[model samples]
Target: MDIVISIASKIAESLVTPIGREFGYLIYYDTNMKDLKDELKQLFEMKDRVQESVKAAKRNGEVINYDVQSWQTSVDKLIQKVLHFEEEVSMKRRCLYRWNISRKATKITQDVLYLQKEGTFNNVAHPAPPPMIWSTFKEGFKDFKSRMTHVNRVTEVLKNEEVRMIGICGMGGCG
Candidate 1:
């Protein structure tokens, strides 16, 4: 009986630690994409639920069943998916930033051409203008904040358990 209890305790520890570590990692991961972040947050909540269920099962000295294992496997797969999505988004954003910089450089060149055509600069020795890359990065941050705010509002509404149904009272043709 003592040996059985010891083995059960060991099993419980093994099961709980990996789930806890995964949960910790997921919570700590920084994601800029609002939808993906929200999905990770939801997964974190699910991890809590699974942890509780595991605890209850352990308290009863019951072996973890196949269904529980399957659920954990699914959660693990979801975490992997989220990580992959994050990497993909990050790469895309980097590409977008580079593209924006190139576009801005072209626009600046066009402005220079227009100024030359208009004879705006009388002096040929003029100081070079400061880079606009910082402004572009700031715009990206603003965009991210706007998206995060919208996602947060929607998440809050959906998470409110009391609000079972939502109605959109807007012009039908406008939508």
Candidate 2:
């Protein structure tokens, strides 16, 4: 009986740890996409605001008196450009997030299977870390480090994409 219990505990430990990590990945993917979805919504709102601004600029009599056709043309072009850039960025971000999630899920599943073979199957039963939980490479966090790195890269790309859009708009306004 003691021998059986000992083997069972060992098997449980081996199975649980990997399971824990995989479950963590699943939670992270869900939370991360939801966060990104929120950002996309904000971007959409900003796009609407930009459109409104263009409309208001077109309707202002004094502005039209000063540079009517040119101003309207510039505003329309700028609005279109900004919107196009934003749409491209949003699409790219969404696609990258999806790809990362699918990749993470697969990796975690494999890890779980591997751990089951080794013993701690139930360790990953809990929700995973939040999207922004940056783990140190040396912290022994396992398969998640790679996925986290991918998430960070996507974040950076989104940041740069936003910056690019803002810079273009700023320059257009000045010109």
Candidate 3:
């Protein structure tokens, strides 16, 4: 009797879970859509603020951070998804349709909330590092004798007032 009851209960539970989840989807359809729309509006506001920062940073010749740029890209893609979902959900006709749409709306609502949280970037950008700049000093010299002569020569040449151009030409590209 105990073994039979355990097997029956397991089978019953497996059947009820999906049905209950679908029912919940139906029940929460309107609420989820409203929350999704509200959250998306807030996300848009954040997007605008971030975009303004990007614009200002560009004006000041600053390079936007990689993560900030990536976030904006994700926002652009999500915009398309939201537009399509909103249009599709507006004409709710069938129970199955609402069930699936509600599920998607719930997922999108969560996504929108996540993006809104991520949009709070403290620093959008910074001045770009100068071109061809290197940190040879920090790493230290591997061959001090060979490299130091070249370094000292270049430094000495740079200090000379009369030398207007430097052309360190050598066989096998020693410079």
Candidate 4:
């Protein structure tokens, strides 16, 4: 019985940690895309509830109930979907980057041809616009901003200044 409980605890920890990490990434991605935010938010909430249920079961020294298992299964499926969505987004970004590079190269070639035909390189009035910003760093920062807002709200409710300071510092470091 002891071994069984230990194994269950380990399994729950392993599953919960990855799910949380994946949910965090999904949230970060959704910050700019906004397409998956609502669905991911629902999954996150469900994960939280499932985690609470597991904790409760552990505290009571009871085996996880069927309802908890069902919740866990649903969360697992949602996480898988989120991962698939991320992969699709990455592929799309790569294709867009290639397209942008090709377009810029073609424009540069045309400009050079015109310069050669006109026999003047001195009258170019405007430089090409900067390449499309492909990195998702901006979206990630927006996600961080939202997380910071939550941290601030939690800190405001904390009675201990030292603890609040630590929490804020911890969140900043994570960012």
Candidate 5:
């Protein structure tokens, strides 16, 4: 029973982790895109309102009612802040996507290592399982190390890219 449970747990974990990671990536992408779209709609609506207010104030010989102008300015600033936040979230989502890829790669590499370690090649004597076992372990470790390094590199690249994108968007007021 203990052995059964242990095997069952490992199997379950192997199955669940990838699916969970994938689901998380999908959810982040979906939610961030939705938020971005909503923010865009809000920006447009704010612009339209600003135009209408200016037109009304102009027709009445006042470009803005002082009190209303203050409120509009505050709302505009808030909207700009929200757009910035959305951009941040989008950047995070991209990072999450990359992280997901790294995680899956690591998982596969580990699974191969696990199977090889469990004597999966014990029966084959023609090619000498000793070299196969040694090489597999060595290669698996190398892959693991490389994957970790790539994950860090990917994260840094993403951070820099996000900063550049934010700067560009801020300058254009198009976020």
Candidate 6:
């Protein structure tokens, strides 16, 4: 008797859980869309504010972060989704379709919220990294006495009119 009761309870709980969740989605479909619309609006505002910062960074010749660029692309794609959803809503939509649309709106709303949190860019853009060639040569270059003598000889060789071609060989690095 005890084993039978336990099995019954488990089966009942599993059925009840899914039914309850589906019912919630169906019942709150309109509410979900409204909340999603409001969140999307706020997301747009946040995106605009961030865009201003990106613009400022560009003007100052700072390189934008990869994450920030990715976020912008995501927002752009979301705008299209919202537009498509809006058109669908404006048309004659069936009650059965409500759940699907509601689910989509809920997902997009959550995405917008996630994006808002990620939009916080304390370091939106950073100073661009120096070119590798510069770092490899100029940055680590030292004016050693021996190196300077080589430099003088190279310059004299270059100044000679008969010298059509020249090559720099030695340390081949900052040395």
**Candidate-wise lDDT, in order:** 0.52, 0.49, 0.88, 0.53, 0.50, 0.85
Worst 10 residues of 6 by lDDT: 132-141
Off by over 4 Å in 4: 1-33, 93-175
Estimate the lDDT of model 2.
0.49
In the range 28-72, model 4's lDDT, one tens digit per residue, is: 442434434444565566566557756765675555655456546
Task: Count steric clashes of candidate 6.
Answer: 0
Considering only N, C-alpha and C atoms within 3 Å, which residue pairs clash in candidate 5? 57-62
lDDT of 1 by residue, 152-171 (tens): 88788999999998764554
The TM-score ranking, best first, is: 6, 3, 1, 4, 5, 2
Model 1: colliding residue pairs: none
Off by over 4 Å in 3: 131-175
**Deviation in Å, model 4, residue 23 alpha carbon:** 30
> Model 3 clash pairs?
none
Best by lDDT: 3
Clashes of 5: 1
Candidate 5: 10-residue stretch with minimal lDDT: 119-128
**Model 5: per-residue Cα lDDT over 1-175, one tens digit each:** 9999999999999999878967665555545445445545554565565557566556655434454455456556555655565455556546555455444334433433332233222111122124233332433333366456656765776778445532212222111
RMSD of 3: 8.9
- Select the stronger candidate by TM-score from 2 and 5: 5
Better of 1 and 3 by TM-score: 3
* Residue 101 lDDT, candidate 6, scale 0-100: 79
| TM-score to native of every candidate shown | 0.32, 0.25, 0.68, 0.32, 0.30, 0.70
Could you give me the TM-score of model 5 versus the true structure? 0.30
Quote the lDDT for 123 in model 6. Answer: 76
